[model samples]
Target: MKSALMGSLKFQIPQLNFHKTLKKPRPSFLRGRPRPPLWRAKRLSTEAIQAIQSLKLARSSAPRLEEVFNNKLSRLLKADLLDTLAVLQNQNELDLALKVFEFVRKEGWYKPDILLYHAMIQLMGRNKMVEMAEEFFGKLENEGLKPDTRAFTEMIGAYLQVGIIDKAMETYERMKASGCDPDKLTFRILIRNLEDAGKEELVDCIKKECGKEAGGRFFLKISSAQNGKVAVADLQYHVLKCQKARNFAVSSCEADLISTLLKLQSRRAHASR
Candidate 1:
C-alpha cells in the first residue's frame, strides 16, 4: 500500500524558460551611437587658397600681380580676404601683405579697426620697417580714429624696435595727453625696454608714475568701500592678496596702513553686527 501511494504522488516538474524572460545583448554599434565630430572654423576656403596661390605665382610683374589679385582675390568673402592677409603677414611677405591691406582698406565695407593696424605695426616692427609702420599709424589717425592704448603701444614698440628712444617717448607722452591712461602692460613695456637701453632716469620716472597710479586707484577703491559700509579690512586683505598674486610690490608704509585699516574695520564691523 505504501509503495503504491509513493508512485501516485510522483509528478513531472516544468523547467524555467530563462531565454524568453532575459533580454538579448545588443550589437556594439547599437549599444551607444557614435558621437558626432566636433565642429571647427575653417581656416581658409578653396577660393582663398586658389587666390593665394595665384598671387604668389604672379610675382613676375606688379601689373600682372595686381590683375591676378583683382580677378581672383577681390571676389572672396571678407573673412577669406582677411584670412589670406593674415597668412601673408605670418609668412613675412611684407609687400604682398601690404598690398592686401591696402586693398582691404579701399573696400566699401571697410571700417577703422585698431586691431588691424596693431597687427600691421607689429609685423612692420618685426621687419624693422619703422617708416612703413609710422605711415600706417598716420593713416589710422587720418581715418579719424582715436588711437587707443594698444595702438599707441604698438607704435611705441615699433619705434623702440629701431632704437628710436626719443620717438618712443614722444609717442608715450602723446598717449597720455590723449587721455588714454597707460595700463600695466604699457608700464611694463616701457620699463623693461628702458632698462634694457640703460635709461635709468626714465625707468625711475616710469616706476614713480606706476606707483602713483596704483596708489590712487587702490585708495579710490578703499574710499568707495567705506562709503558702501563694506568692511575695510576685508577689502584691504583682498587687495593685498590680489597684488601678491599678480606679483605687485607694496611699500612698507602702504602695507602697514592696510593692516591697521583692516583691523579697525574688522572691529567696527563686529561692533555694528
Candidate 2:
C-alpha cells in the first residue's frame, strides 16, 4: 500500500532555458547612443599650403626666402601665419619653421609669447639642437618676458637630451633663482633622467630641494629593489613611480633625507608647544 501511494504521487521538475532567460545586449546605435567621432587635425587651407611650398622652395637662398615672405606670405592673417608655423614645426622642418617664426615675431601685431618659444625649444630639443634652443630662450628673455615653468622645463629637457647633465643642472638652478618654482613635472624629469644617467647624488639633492620647497609638507623617498639601484617613491597621496623602479624594496633613510627634515620639524613644533 505504501509503495503504491508513493508511485501515485509524481513530482514535476521544470527545466530552465538559460538561453531564453538572458537578454542579449543591444548595439549602441540601436540603443540611441552612438560613439563620438575621433578627432582629426584640421586640414590646412590652399593658400597656407602654397605659402609653405613657396617657403620651402626659397629656403636655399636667404634673400629669395625674404622676398617670397614679403611678397606672398606677409599678407596672411595672423591666425594663418601662426598655423603655418605650427605645421612647419610639426613636420620637423626646423629651418623653415625658424624662418616663419622670425616673420611672425616681426609682425606689428606680434607680442612676446613664452608658449611659442617653448614649442620651438621643444622642437629643437627633439632634434638635439641645443644651441638653437638656447638662442630662442635667450631671445625670450631679451623680450622682457619672464619664462614660465614650462619654458624652463623645456630648456632643461633640451639640455638633458644632449646628455649635458651639467647644463641641465645649471638651468634648474637658474630656474629657481629666477623665482620660477619647479613643479612635479620638473622633479620627475630631473629625477628620472638623472637616475637613468646614474646621477644618484643629483637625485638625492633634488629630493632635498623638493622637501625644502614644499616646506616639509610633501616628500619623496627612494627605494632599491632592482640590482640595488635607487628608485624614487612619492610618499604623498599620489605615488609617482619611476618606470625603471618596478619592484619596490624597503625605503632607505639615506635616500630620504626629506623624512629626517620632517621629523626635526615635527619635534620643533612639539618643543615650541
Candidate 3:
C-alpha cells in the first residue's frame, strides 16, 4: 500500500511542474508612480545657481542689485534672498542688504518676519547706525509687526553703545510696559551697564523688579497672554549659554527714572494686539 502511494505521488509531480511553468506573473502597482530626479538631491538648478552668482556680483551697486533681483524674481526663492542678505551682512555691506531687503519687501511674494527684522536691527547696531535702528524699530511697530524680546534687547544695547543711557532705559521701560519681560541677556546688559556707570541703586532696583533666584540661576517672568504664569527662566538660561559660547559681553546703562511697576501694568492694560 505504501509503495502504491509513492507511485501515485511520483506520477503527479510532472503535472504539477508543468502547471507551475504555465503560471502568470503578478501585476505591479508602482510602475506608473513618478520617481524624483536624481540630480535634484545633489545640487541646485542651473537657473538658481546663476541667480545667486548674479546677486553676489551685483552687491556693489544698489541700482544694479535691484535690477538683478527683479530679473531673477521668477526664479529666485526666499531662501536665496535670505542667503544673499547673510552674505551682505558677512561682508559688512548692511546698506546693500537693506536695499535688497526693501526690494524684497515690495515683491508680491514677500512677507515680513521677526527673525529677519532682528537680523536687520543687529546689523544696524553693529554698524553704529543707532538712529537708523530706532527708525527701523518704529517702522516695524507702524507696520503692526511686534518686535520680539531679543530685538528689544538689541535696541537697548544699541542705545547704551551710543552713550544714550536715557534712551536705553526708556527702551527697557517701553518693553516691560508692553507686557514683555526682560530675558537674562536683558538683565545682564542693563545691570552691567548701570553698575559700570556707578548706578548701583538702579541695578538693584531692576533686579528686584524683574527677577528672582531659582536653582542657582536668575529668572525673569514677563506678563504673557496667560497673565504672568509663564516663566522665561529656561529660555533666559539657554540665551546665556549661547552668549557664553559666542563670548557676548554684558551691556550697561545710565538714565533718569520714569515709571514704576504700576505704570508698566497700566501700559499693559492699554496695549493692543
User: Top TM-score: which candidate number?
Assistant: 1
Which of candidates 2 and 3 is the stronger one according to TM-score? 2
lDDT of 2 by residue, 1-273 (tens): 987776655322223343356778853221124323211366677778788889888999989998889887898888778878988887779989988898889999999898799889988887889999999899999999889988998899888887899999999998999989987668767877888799988887887665444432445564547777777665542113321111121122223345544444455468679
Q: Candidate 3: TM-score?
A: 0.55
lDDT of 2 at 91: 74
Off by over 4 Å in 2: 1-43, 61-64, 207-273
For candidate 3, the 10 contiguous residues with the lowest summed lDDT are: 249-258
lDDT of every predicted structure (CA atoms): 0.71, 0.73, 0.63
TM-score against truth, every candidate: 0.63, 0.59, 0.55
Which wins on TM-score, candidate 1 or candidate 3?
1
TM-score of 2: 0.59
Off by over 4 Å in 3: 1-63, 72-74, 213-273
Q: Write the per-residue lDDT of candidate 3 for residues 75-149, one digit (tens) a residue.
A: 567666656565555455776678777866776777767777776776787677998888878878877898778
lDDT of 3: 0.63
